[model samples]
Target: MDFTFSTEELLIQQMAREFAEQYLRPATRRIEKENRVPDEILAGLAGLAGLDLFGMNIPEQYGGAGAGYLSYVLAMEQIARVHCGPGLILSAHNLGLGAIANFGTDEQKARFLPKAASGEHIASFAFTEPGTGSDPKQLTTTAVRRGDEFILNGAKRFISNAGYQGPLTVFAIEAESGVPTAFIIDKFCPGYSISQPWEKLGWHGGDVVDFNLKDVVVPLDNVLGKIGDGYPILQFGIAYGKIGMNSLALGSTLAALELAVRYANERTHREQPIAKFQAIQLKVAEIAGLYESSRWLCYRLGFLANDPKSYRDFAREAALAKAVVARNAQEAARISLDVHGSYGLMQDAEIARVYRDAAMGPQIEGVLHMQQIILAGDILRKR
Candidate 1:
């Protein structure tokens, strides 16, 4: 696979890096303490929407940049290195938005794509129920066809972007057909309400909403793809989520790793830099190694995403990328803190926030163990 980036990807990377340093980093303290991303920053992020920073991989006809797969992931990695709120928000939005781009009808695309691409109307994915997250078959949410509308009843927990004013694409079993279907339920729909946002462990400053859909009425025009075809659509969204999450992991870890290296060199012992110490050297090496490995893995998956027939094959690749990067990102953050010694653990330190942000990567998009199981199965099948 070619490692070179096109002119567009380079521009996105540079622009995102500048945006992160100039705007996002300056507000890190406020974000970490307040756990809120201001609307202005979000709107600033929207300015890049035309560059596919938010709408990457979405076709140009729909008002996005129609970026190549690598461009999308590269933009994510750049922004994620500075802050988790925007990083995860963009990824989470794209998680369901990409599905709509791929599966929605012409009218549906025309109705939502341009606005969504411009970041005017954000989208959320509602799939994780109260007791079911990874296992969709156990979803208790059911949608019943009634006249011209589908009546939905169930609660969705840990839904990203639910607090935002936009449409949510919900996943539920169609009672009569016993087929899982994706329905776009507008925030204004009847009986559709969001519970209080959850206080998250790491990715804060953004909404993580719980959906309570009691007889939520959605028009027939809202269905994404055909009935019983939700699986592939869901999987596609998930694959992109993993892909972006992989970038999130890489971005945060690389940031921590580079900072640790600089700290080691600048910090001194016996009037000499700590870079002379082999222990510090080893930690830097480990972080570097993981970053390189994960970067290549994510890049490879970007290429895999281009082949429509490689969807399932890309599933395992996405999982592997997420699993490895998540684990390694955590390790990198820990070692980065170690390099700073007690200073890193101090509440006011920047690395402390970075550590917390890095902590979220492994847990989301399915746990690391699940990804490992998928990877193992892929290995066995190949052999």
Candidate 2:
């Protein structure tokens, strides 16, 4: 494999780096303390939109930049280098756009993609219900057709990006077929309300809320893909979501590793820099290796996206990537904190927040064990 980024990819990565330094780095402390994102994603989204980014991985015909998966991943990694908050905001919005781009009718595309491309609107996806997380087969959200509209009734929790008043792509079972279907509903639709904001451990800058659809009305034209085809659409969307989340892992891990290496060299112990110590050396080596492994996995997933045959294989790989990178990043962050000694625990120290975010790795995307089940399924399929 070439293992080289294209010009576009490099440019986007550079842009992301700059975005993080200016917008994210300066605000990390405040965002964590205030527990609000300050509409943070909007700033980055507007900037990227100028570069024709917002829906970059989607096709141009769908009002995206058509920059390909690798370019998007490169940008996402850079943005995530600072913190998971902003990157997650963009990621969740993209997931909503991807579902529409991949499955929506031309009219639906014409209506939503243009606004999405320019960052004029953001989006959120709702799938996980109050009772269901992993097993979605028992989803109780039902959509019944009534003339030109569909009436929806259900509730979903742990939904990111739902705090925004934008288009929401919700998954519900069609009343007649009892099969999962997706619909695009306006946030202002009557009977659609988000539950009170939920406090979270990490990712404090972004919004996380529960979404409820009580006899919500959705136009039949907004149905994404065929009725009962939500399973595949959901899979395809989350496959990319997994890749994006783990890419954040790679970026955060890189930050942690860099911080540790720098701290080891600058910190003094016994009248000598801690870099002189073998223990510090081992920690740096472990972190660098782990980061490199997880990062390469992200790049591979980006490339695999170009090949249709690899998608089935890619889904399992994506799950593994999320799980591995989350674990690896947490380990790297812990060692980095240890290298900082007691200073790392101080709220004034930036690494303190990075440490907290890293500890949240297993919770992002999906739990580590659940992802392992996907890998196990792949193994059994091979047999």
**Which predicted model would earn the best TM-score?**
1
Predict model 2's lDDT versus the native: 0.80
The TM-scores, one per candidate, come to 0.95, 0.94
Candidate 1 C-alpha error for residue 370, in Å: 1.7
The 10-residue segment of model 2 with minimum total lDDT is 39-48
What is each predicted model's overall lDDT from 0 to 1? 0.81, 0.80
- Which residue pairs show backbone clashes in model 2? none
lDDT of 1 by residue, 52-140 (tens): 56667778898877776787778778777887787777878787678888889999888877877777777788889889788878888
Model 1 TM-score? 0.95
What candidate 1 gets wrong by more than 4 Å, as runs, is 44-52
